[model samples]
Target: MHERVATTPSLMIKRRLNATPAEVFEAWTDAKLLMQWFGPENVVTQEVSVDAQVGGGFRVVMRENTGERHEVRGTYSEVVANEKLVFSWSWITTPERVSRVSVTFKPDGAAGTILTLLHEQLFDEQAVKGHTHGWTGSLAKLEALFA
Candidate 1:
């Protein structure tokens, strides 16, 4: 008999933006701005649907350079104006890929905003590492947008 196995991996990323919390939050809630910096260099996201309100859902198809497409679906679990966002996310390509993400926006002492991201329920160490880099790079793109 095969024994039960469990695999859960996670990654967290925090970034500071040279903008206000409201501005950062707007970038996320606004689909147009979100498309400006949501994926990798060769990947583009086509947002099929987005309902930003709490309990509302969103789905987007990410197309890679080679035209490979992946679908991501999520629903907003919680939202606080200019402060925090919590959501349940999963990839349609990977059934077991389930995660809850929390993002906090705080005002920096000076004139910036600190964005703290917490991603939980990954599948393995490799996934955690890959996602770390992926998230960091994406955040960089976001910073570029504000700059």
Candidate 2:
């Protein structure tokens, strides 16, 4: 029998964006917009595709300044315009290590939108720590896009 690997640990991030909910949602679900702010500070997104619908899929390719490359793809399981998105997440090199990502956008009146991103099903605490750094750097770029 094949042993099942337990999926646990999650990375959570909450930030207030200076854009409207619709704008923030579009930044996440639109390929062109995503490419502009999809990777860490030292990485540049080389390619991106977002289907933006339930059952649809998205892919991203990022390249680091040192020539290292990373590719990840996943299928969308849930999509709610300007509100919520849930999708599978997996790197091309480790397709078996699948994970999930959920992002929610909430209106915040004068503050614009409150964006929350939850990445779960990580392989281990190391994965969580790595992703936390990755997401934090990526989000700083995303935040600057509206600032």
* lDDT of the candidates, in the order given: 0.82, 0.94
Off by over 4 Å in 1: 1-7
What residue pairs are clashing in model 1? 9-122
lDDT of 1 by residue, 1-147 (tens): 999544466677888899999999988888788878887677787765767789998787778889898788899999998999888888897867778888999999766998999878877787678668767877989989888
lDDT of 2: 0.94
- Give the runs in model 2 whose Cα sits over 4 Å from its true position: 1-7
Q: For model 1, what is the error of residue 110's alpha carbon versus the real structure, in angstroms, after optimal superposition? A: 4.9
Highest-TM-score candidate: 2
**For residue 123, what is the lDDT in candidate 1?**
73
